[model samples]
Target: MPFKTYLINKTNNRKFRLDGVLRSRRLPAKHKLCQKFRQHMVLRTDQLPPKVDLRPDMTPIEDQSQIGSCTANCLAGAYEYLTKKSNGMNMDVSRLFIYYNARIKGNY
Candidate 1:
């Protein structure tokens, strides 16, 4: 018998984390157990209703510019703002600027 890690995805958007002795090819066993658990939960939901709540606002997502380097395009602008507000450092390095430099140098 070989040791294995079984990642069981359940219907209720939950997972079954089982790490112990299981029979060889016990996938059917795990799936049946998860189904039984879901059935039990559905029976309990009759007594309790779920609540719908909205999450709090953190900040707005910045627009993405097509300058090749999406990684720097996203963070470089945000980091400029953060550094300017917190540490009083004015650093403006955009993906468009980098792309322009790369083009001028005939490297890309």
Candidate 2:
């Protein structure tokens, strides 16, 4: 078992105060967990294709150069890809529109 102590406060009048203690009991060793994680993340680089372009049709590489609206751009791109794939329709969704709507909804 491992334990950690957290200090709540150190007031000018009082010296110090203990806030809480966190105790953790290990079911498996650290090395074992690391080995398992490494095994899960192992990839065969040679088997992968040299070039993979998964972008959908009408999915433009947007230049959100001036605006800080990367989240909106990504959302619109995903929407275009999904809609095109599902319905075979090539509709260009406006990133600015999505950005404004998200800002109104307080999502950003």
Candidate 3:
């Protein structure tokens, strides 16, 4: 895992550390994901459902041990969800396939 660490400027004789995704990185800004979705009418706060549960749609958990393939695993879960939603079939997807392809494209 690649992490960039930074020290805060407003420190009073104490060290403050911050570590997270690098915002300036290309991947984070390269795509505007929101634009891909169809625009829907904005719902008023009162019109929204009181409770929403998507857990029912989610399949069984997948253990990823420690191979640093979080992205691939996430994509696989999403793919499984789409598959089930499209054809109502619970399928096990190959995380390695997605991982290898992403790694090749990303050059990680």
What clash pairs does model 1 have?
none
* lDDT for each residue of candidate 3 in 1-108, tens digit (9 for 90 to 100): 557566756756555557665444334454665334455677799999999987767788988888888988999999998888778898999999999999899897
Positional deviation of residue 64's Cα in model 3 after best superposition, in angstroms: 1.0
- Tell me the TM-score of model 2: 0.46
TM-score order of candidates, best first? 3, 2, 1
lDDT at residue 21 of model 2 (Cα atoms): 52
Report the C-alpha displacement of residue 59, candidate 1, in angstroms.
9.2
CA shift of 29, model 2, Å: 48
Pitting candidate 1 against candidate 3, the one with the higher TM-score is 3
Question: Which runs of model 2 end up more than 4 angstroms from their true locations?
Answer: 1-53, 56-58
On residues 1-108, what C-alpha lDDT tens digit does candidate 1 reach at each position?
446556666666565656656545444555646443343344476576587332221123445655456655566666666666666656666666755665778765
Q: Write the per-residue lDDT of candidate 2 for residues 1-108, one digit (tens) a residue.
A: 234444545554443434445544555556656443443455599977799777645576889898999999899988999898879898888999988998989965
Q: Considering every candidate listed, which one attains the maximal lDDT? A: 3
Error at 87, model 2, angstroms: 1.9
The top-ranked prediction according to TM-score is 3
The regions of model 3 sitting more than 4 angstroms off are 1-41
TM for every model, in the order presented, reads 0.26, 0.46, 0.55
lDDT of each: 0.56, 0.75, 0.80
Give the RMSD in angstroms, all C-alphas superposed, for model 1.
14.8
Error of 1 at 1 (Å): 64
